[model samples]
Target: MRVTVLLAAAAVVVTAPRWLPARVVALRRKVFEKVNGDNVITFPNAAVGPDRFQEVYSHPAANGRSRGAGLSDLFWYWLSPGPEVHQEHLEAGPRYDDVARTTRALLSGPADALSAAAARCAARVLDETVTGRVTLVRLRDLMMPVWAEYFYELVFGEPCPREARDLIVGHADDVVSALKCTGLRHPARRARLTRYLARRVAAGDVRHPLPATLTPTEQVHYLQGTFYNTGVVQMSDAMAHLLLALAQHPDVAARLADDPADDRYFTRVLDETMRLYPLFGIAHRITTAEIELDERTTLPEGSVLCFSYPDYHASGHARPDVFDPERWEHTPVRESHHIPFGVAANRPCPAWRLSPLALRAATGEVLRRFTLHSTVAHTRSLPNRGACLLVRVGEPLPPRRLARIGALLRVRDRWEHVWRSVVQLVLGTVMVLHARRLRLAGRYFDPRPTAGCRVDQPPSSQENTA
Candidate 1:
């Protein structure tokens, strides 16, 4: 009995660090559940079991009675179970109901309604930002539809049909239907999309080539996953945070307005903004087999592995809470752990490069169009949802400066061409390396079970369970 106790103690010591973050997260969740009512405490190492990936990422069990709800669940599954997931329990929160209700309303309108609504949303965003009369909540509303429409068009090769668009836009409901055991809404949508694609194929009008390997059904779901997981849900979140950063640092905005072509500065600002407020707070991964962390530590095959950006960004830096873009300037070596998207070498977000471009375009447009102003009270609206910004839009750029901007714009175009070439080259290199790695692993263009970790097998259980 004494020997058994000693061996258990030794084992705990050996494996503690490997599982320490997860344990800390579990403890924090328990504490949140106790202090803040409606917190959903997840099962320990939920990402480990093949049965729990949906529960970890999508939490399909969270929807209420509303149709087309819970479609835009964020990526972090560590600190908080999805806002909607708690609805499965007795003590659900208002957030779940709010997301469901809002999504349903947003998606209930006709298909063309979404495209029209997106145009209106874009118009409002441009108007508000140009006038300097916007808040984070308002920004979120304006930008959400834009991303939804973009993803919809990208996936389906045309604007979403009114009915189909409604279902797709209400991500919560779509995700629940796709992932959860609730009902057949998602499956029906997949079938409709598949049939539509088949018709297009038959007519030789297909805009994008369908992957020949996957079944038509699998192809539909694959498109849906690409649409949902890439950057659609996070675009508004990232843009809102960037705007908040700009509001606080108007000098940055001024510099951007004056030298709109200086993408290096914009890249630094973007890096810092993402460092502080990454859209997905945590990234999820799982071990496929028992792995040794060191001679002393071994993790089981089914262990859930999480990378917490908050913890990682907070540690190993000075004044991490402060908004400082200069920290990422070309001064020191970059760390591998400060990943906002997944690791650049492996499972980076498909929208990673595109998102920064969007932010840059939006920032330049707003700065060039209006004189922006905000107060501390307005900035506080960022962390808390539903609060409006206390902002004031001043006069538009005078004709004289506008002419100067036009002249500068010509120079900027030349600079941008050069910059874009460099970016493309770097991106091409990264893609080549990523492709090589995939080929080496024997899973190029095929879905792998472990997102961050590689193992001998691709964990077939998740595909079956999914």
Candidate 2:
């Protein structure tokens, strides 16, 4: 009996890497369902098919964000310090218009200029950091400082000071970490960046004029939350995904390297990358009015609609699971079930054009400097942060050495997933419950609006509509 028990234990240990992570994910999903309750309605469900996704998404009634939804509280909590003023979170109104105009103005530089700036920033980071012929890096960590500098230059029209860069990186990292549920929220780290932005605003250092509707403090939060927090973090994650995709597919990487001027091919690669690993998982909206899906089926007002990006991208493609940029060669991205930046009628990503241009430039710079390789798992969540090896140009690792590194990375990443899933479960649950208890979004939308109230103040119930 003792010998049998030891054998069973050994078998379980050997298989844990394959089975444990999936089990944890299942548990995590269950926990999420339990915490958020059944009020939320997911897209691609029976009533809302892939064909109707855009229509439903673009519906005039489907524009509510923070009001009457438990999930909004969770988003508000993670994005706090000024989630209210954050352009993405604000209800559709004058305030959102002002914020949107300011964002557009800030990002209005020529595409080539933005691209050049991104490449310059990336090259500078690599020159300072890559001290060895071969270096192992978490791609997200490597890209964060690059974007920090890029955005800082965009905001101030000057080189990013090391102090400011550090603060930006720190705050963005904390926000994404907490968002991924790999780490808890550190308000102090975020607060430091807020204070720095406040000082900058007070000094009249911002190059673009901020929204007139916001108070001075709200203006500081707006910069911190919108430009530094969301902009830096999303771009970093995007570049990490792009680099990791190149690392995993050596043939594609080689092709890209050989044809440096192949902008068309690179665009296909970028589109495919975004399809496979969309920056957003679930984008939720609360319906302000009844959505008439058909004469028989109607989604009532205040319904929470959760649009699944990964699921939608997975549909309407042959061998959707495969990563083949060639597919895009035959099919235009516009005709496909691809809304990477969301629909045009709704809140599309503000950086839609600028991001692709910047990513192309940054990626070109990295490819010029290093040959990227990785064997780690590449999921949309990217909890592992893209473990990759960067071999300096003209110095390649022997095949055997590369295989050994790949094997070790595979093992390390598998075990890490086992641990990370549990951490996500625990932290995700705590944060969801805490957000509910705080009722940040709920309270913000609960108060009735009065005349002369500040735009950033908790909006009135009537103002919550689309």
Candidate 3:
């Protein structure tokens, strides 16, 4: 009986992130509707049932006292109740935090340097994918080191500190220690880079914000954000999906390969690719107060709200799922309904401009060299299932090795299933008992606008709709 109870509890805990908050969100909606009467903006299919798929909407007040989830704040692990493994796959932790900080720093610190670094990294990634027996995930894995080196080089310059080198090359075991090295080096390096940028600004060479303006700690944080949290995962996912889409549509691939200089085609391809397979596909928020949505609907304080294109895109676009770049030909690119980088209103991705250009160049390079073949049919889930959509450059892995790999993959899947079930039962009970507290904690970040981003809303006129 005790064992059965434990199992039951785990099941509830595992499922709590979805059902519990959803129940509260629903109950609060009804209560508010009764009290306020008919003004509450009714969310279509807001309640996420056991099928675990539903459409939800959030209305972020364009005024003060409301806040949106930051890039660091929004995540599946934080939003959903699942095993730690779900988040682990997304790299949603301290390591991710470090990477996010770095990426952000690179964005605002040095534009030219950042773009150059990204270009070099793209070239390297393209070279590897063209030559090696590569899959989307494997190519991305190989590109990580190249990106790290270029990033550090742009920041710290050649003959990078031994500690920094050790960290990037994976020689260092402790990520914290590696970060510490960057933490210490950043202050002095930032000062120097700042002075250089100032000179460039004086000469009218630079247009973006100076990294020197940020304190050493802030600079380091921003730099970490750039590579780990933003660029590596999102860009990689976009590239993978683009390759898959191209593989499936050889006609498009041939046309794109023919015109490397045609910027329009490149932009359309990249935009459509991002629309279809956004890596950070979901936008999440936690309500700070009772959000009044047109006087009829109000979201309760501390409520978790989420939006994904897959769920909500149909309201604005016709045949949203069909991979058609021509749809974007007539429509605006930055429509609020289309949030590839993020919801444009509250939390737009800092690397939005850079991500596309880098990806387009990479795509062009890849198409220029080899004809890609899709080994897998579809993408797995959010934060992209890189393993699911397999690709081969030339020859497949040898039969013996392929069998061993296949066996290992099956074993891993089984273990994950068992682990998820066990964890759900164990954690689900705790979650049930403290469901309210969990929802309150699920907000991810405080209720304040993220710094260093435009305050303007997307063309759809939603404030930080992500």
Candidate 4:
């Protein structure tokens, strides 16, 4: 009896990798829903489906960003030190306009110059880090330094000092780590970058003039939050996804490497990579007025609409789960259900034009230097941060050795997720509650502007109620 009990316990332990993570993820979702409340409605639900996803997202009434949702507080907390000044969170007003204009000015430049900058930054990072024939790395971490330097150049119009690069990378990594729920946020780490930006602004080291409407402090916050925080983090994640896809699909990688100037094929691969592993999971918006789905169905004002990018991208395609760049050869991007960047009718990604050019150039540099390979799950959240092996161009690994490395990575990632999911549940719940207590978004919007429409209140029957 004792031997049988011991054997059973051992069996459970051995098989835990295959089962534990999924259960934890389900439990984590439940905890998240409970903490965030039930005031939210999801797209692709019973009433709304894929066909109306773009319609709901592009609706004029669905414009409120920071008000009416409990989730906003969590975002604000994660992006603190100046969440109020962050362009994306601000309400539609003069302040948002000014922020938008400044962002445009910062991003505006020759496409070739942007591409060259990305390649230069990527080459520097590769030279410093890739010292071995077979280098194991977290793709996101490997990409972060390159973007840290790239964005630093964009902001200050000079090569990034090592000190500034380190600070920016640390801050962006912390923000994304907390966002993925793989790690808790370190406020001190983020504050270090904030202080550096503050000092730079004070010294008048910024190459471009910031929005004049904002205070000096807000100006510092704008630089840190917009360019340093979001810019570095998102670009790193995007490169990671793109590189990992190339690593897994060696056929595509070999083709691109052989013909490095194949911009058309590279563009297709980028689009398909984004579709399979979209950067954003769910983007939430608050309705400022009643949205009539049809004559019979109407969404009440102040309703929270959670748009699921994954679901929408998954729909309206044959085998949408597969990564097939060839599909784009026939169908135009405008005609497809793909929206890697958000809808054009709404506040689309500010970096939409420059992002592809930069990514293509950076990826070109990476491919030129190394042949990438990976055998791990590629999810949108990228909780594992894309475990990959980079082989120097002329030094290819034997198949047996490559298989061994892949096996080790697979086992390691599975075990890591078991613990990671638990951390996410615990820390994610705590942060949500803490954000609620702080009431960051709640207080920010409490003054209730009387201009166009109120997002805090529900539409009354006398008004335009459903």
Candidate 5:
């Protein structure tokens, strides 16, 4: 009967998404509200992506060498068409400007911005088709220069910190220069590299804001573009945490064999886990345009700083020393309380509803099919504001192994029919044992966000990687 029930449960997990309900989107947003970002109600940002990238390729002067117009091209994870975006900008010429301007009007900022973005986008596209590798150094070179020359100087419009400027520019350059070409063999690593660089560029300092004349909608869209990599990286980190968590839980076999989302098991895990670790948490921006934070920090045009997320989430610590989630049970649910995603209004997390729901389905699959027992207690840390996790798994072992174990196999023929019941008993006991372990050991802990990043780290750093 237990085996029959397990089989049935597995079937349910596979079919649940079609039945997950549309209202789940609202639920997702609500959770994002509680643990993802700042609760400020604002319009959506980041509306201009595809067109923004297309502009540079449009002009004869806009050759694919350096990104001439748009800064948004770094967002694309895929390959581009040229050696450099600048080459395309030159090739594109006036036609480039016309199309770029048109795109910018819709996307945010100015047409020139879109054109620049498009040129970079084209360069990437062309480079991929030609060299089949991305120019990581170029990405950093472009972004850092923009921030240093334009973003810092213009937005700051005051005495900027020479140290901060040096740190940001130098580190960006280091990251880019450190990049080496990886060929077809290391496709996965290449993709990871792409994401890492893109995140840095997207989340890195901006050289300037949209001209004061732009509408609110345009401003929001531009901010959205700025956070592209931030969102992507966060999602990636969260997923890594979930995978590690599954490795620690032994009964993952049953969950994998039969998905848990069907039975609300995955849902429960997702709710707790997402709260604990958010991937895209925290944000920082220049207050040049003039906004409010509080009494301690006032209006300084280009002061580089960030909103705290790790500290906010961990605020309910058991003690100054011990980190415990149980303590947070008493803590009221609040918007800025966590923020593994950004806290700002316009830059609200786009994948808020998307991530948890996906987590449920994906995690449910993982738990049902594998026997992931934690041999070690994995401790998450963000020394560099990114997830560098280490853990071990016992592998395809567990209740399923019972049927494969010779000793556990029932006797054959007539005897087999009689002993089959005994085999069943053995299997059930093993499943229960695995289940118990998963519950007792916090091996299945989710990735929670934390505050604090070194001068070399991004502000929203966390083991809370998506």
Candidate 6:
């Protein structure tokens, strides 16, 4: 018994750090369930698997009942969930009038609705996702400006103002550094992110960014930098989807292990991979102007609008209703109708290029190298589903190789470290200026015009659960 206990302890000592993050383990319970009968909290959202995903985004075809009437709906409500908004159902107006006439003139065909919609969605994607080419050829001249344009739009909107553009371009490392400088002490996430980004791009896993420079202290700040929100997004979706994908197609792990950058096949695998487990449940927007939707319902200026991504992915019932990766292999090109990035023209996720690529690299590496097989295969919705599969990964590789990998990783990791130090320096400055502001607990001031006003102002109700 003593020897057995010692062996088990030795195994644990040899393994722990390689396969898990402290937060993943801390939130593991919410990520999975022992006896999930009804609703369970996943990630501040109650995902009744995909059903919850569907309900929030679209009307149930049978009765036009909205899924917003569920526990999962509570998440956004908690964040200003009320002002219950509805879709702009032109049925309330002359259904066959202006919109139809306007659409017809451009496409000139009854079936052109599909084409027109596709074009509109394409234009929006171009505005939102595309920037200038930043390749080996374009890196020296085109890259900084390209990223500046994108970052500018990402900031307060509208090309980041000409004055600020200079700061962004000249202070590339400084900007990444500023984010790292938060020092909130969560494993220097940004610093790690830079290293991770470099590895994936170098390995041809995804597109690459321009090179950057920074000092050691700056790197530390970058690691601790502000991730904004996508860090939460990535964690939630990966936890849920990883389990589902493994369970549905047991061999995928092996294939990814053999080659992590098999983009053609693996991309498809993760295509529906995102569908089965989306990073978000739903996104909320308040109606900007009052207009009649479906005629029967009139939204005052304060109405809340929401669109659920999970629902759309989940709703195609016959189309791999379960967590099946093969379905993604043949998954058709989806439009606004099935968006996980949100239905609005503006998507809040900024590091999209890097994020998905990072997720892919991580998933491929872990699945191939470690083998994450959970006895359980489930989802809740709170964390991503409320519950995910509980994985049991293999121990890390041996010391000699480990030492070598660590050294190389460290040298390559300098970019992240330097970037973070610069960010921390900036954050330190911000802190000194607002030392009194920091005195406030939990709530940070937004200084924006409508800082305190209740947004998505619907008639107040008890906070919705999910």
Among the numbered candidates, top lDDT falls to 2
- Per-residue alpha-carbon lDDT of candidate 2 for residues 330-390, written as tens digits (9 for 90 to 100): 9989999999899999999999989989998999899998999899999998989899999
Predicted structure 6, TM vs. truth: 0.38
- Write the residue-wise lDDT of candidate 1 on 1-466 in tens digits: 9999999999876655456534544553444334322222232233333233233333223222211111111111110112112222112245334423322332234444433444443454466443444332344444555565555554444665555544444553343322211222233443444455445445645345544544444434344444443334466667667765775577886777689889898888888887777665544444444555347745555444444556555555678788888877753525422556645433345455455655666566556554443332222113221122323345355656544654654344334334333343444334333323333222311355466434532213222212
Looking at candidate 4, the ten consecutive residues that score lowest on lDDT are 457-466
What is the lDDT, from 0 to 100, of the residue 297 in candidate 3?
53
Superposition error at 243 for model 5 (Å): 2.5
lDDT of 4: 0.87
lDDT value for model 2 = 0.89
Question: Residues 314-404, candidate 4, lDDT per residue (tens digit)?
Answer: 8888999998999898989988889999999889999999999999999999999899989888898898999999999998999999999
Cα shift from native, residue 163, model 4 (Å): 0.3
TM-score of each: 0.51, 0.96, 0.53, 0.95, 0.34, 0.38
Better of 2 and 4 by TM-score: 2
Error in Å for residue 359 of model 4: 0.4
Model 4 lDDT, residue 147, Cα:
96
**Each candidate's lDDT (Cα)?**
0.44, 0.89, 0.44, 0.87, 0.32, 0.36
RMSD of 1: 19.6
Q: Which 10-residue window of candidate 5 scores lowest in summed lDDT?
A: 75-84
How do the residues 78-97 of candidate 3 rate in per-residue lDDT, one tens digit apiece? 22211111222122345334
**Native-to-model Cα distance after best TM-score fit, residue 43 in candidate 2, in Å:** 0.8
